[model samples]
Target: MDEQALIPDSQQGDLNAFNRLVLAYQDLAFNIAYRMLGDEARAEECTQEAFFSAYRHLGSYRGGSFKAWVLRMVTNACYDELRRRKRRPVIPLEPLNDTDEEIESPAWLASSDPSPEEVVHLKELDTAIDHCLSTLLPDFRSVVILVDVQNMEYEEVSSILKSPLGTIKSRLARARQKMRDCLQGFEELLPSEYRHEQEGK
Candidate 1:
């Protein structure tokens, strides 16, 4: 059955239909939570809470896009988790004598014969991205993630975020500019072929 059929069925307490919906969206939901929280255990907890909240509130749902509804719930859960973490910060203990060795480069990066200097530059770029994303205001970061990273359209993101379309566009534009500026410092990280392309731009 299509999504429209599934929603009514699941709303009416069809466990199988609901399970199917969960299976279909669980990965996407988890990834959103993980990316937002940057902690695996916290992400899992947020995902579970979001699902349970959706299940409990299923009766309240009226006609609309079910996927978007669930995503809004998941995003809210992540925001709640972020707020709670801010109130009480706890650091995880570090592992000692770790058996796992760090690989010099990811498999995709390893395939290319990048010079060591290039590799270091790339690593710096990656760090710069992480740092900039972390520094973003929560509202702006959420917009960036929903649009740029998750590839959500403006209307869909607006619905999920309960914001105006113009607000979404403005936030997305600002967020992207911030990311661009952050990455600008690592221009040397671009592969030799891409460096020429960048210079031409």
Candidate 2:
């Protein structure tokens, strides 16, 4: 069924219907969390919490752009998590790059029949992008993730972030500039097309 059909059922306390929405959105939600927090476990936790919060608040949903509404929830959850972590920071024994072996092999990045060389290049590009994203402030990072990575429009991101459109545009501009500077350092690892795109920035 279409997502619109699922929403009413989910709003009526149908667990299965809500779960279908979860299945549809969890990957994108988790990716947003992961990109925001840079921790898989925390990302998973935030995604689950966002879903729970959504189910509870479903009645309050005023229609229009359910996906964007869900994203707003997940974004709030991530922000909350970030705030908590700020209060009690813990150092991980493993470095980010060391722990990202699995991230380097995401199924979404795979072609139906990717060559060994292509796979390696994809991994490198993913790592490079991740590193660049990590250097950004959380607010700037979130803007770029929503706009550039998640392919959201400026208005949608502004709505999700509850910020003004001009604020969103400014954050996106600064974030993109940061990423361009960061990516320039990793130009050799980027695919030719991506390298050209970066260079053109």
In lDDT terms, which candidate is top?
A: 2
Over 1-201, each residue of candidate 2 has an lDDT whose tens digit, in order, gives 589989999888889998999999999999999999888999999999999899989999989888889999999999999889989887434322445643444443323333444345545777667767877888999999999889989989988898999999999999999898777666677669977786688
Cα displacement (angstroms), candidate 2, residue 22, comes to 1.2
TM-score of each: 0.76, 0.79
RMSD of each: 7.1, 8.4
* Residues 1-201, model 1: lDDT tens digits: 477778789889998888788888899899887767766798899999989998999899987778789988888998998788779977533323246655443443333333445445557654445455655667788888888778989999999889999999999999888876655556676457757877999
TM-score of predicted model 2?
0.79
Residue 76 Cα positional deviation in candidate 1, in Å, after optimal superposition: 0.4
lDDT of 1: 0.77
Best TM-score goes to which candidate? 2
Off by over 4 Å in 1: 91-131, 185-201
lDDT of each: 0.77, 0.84
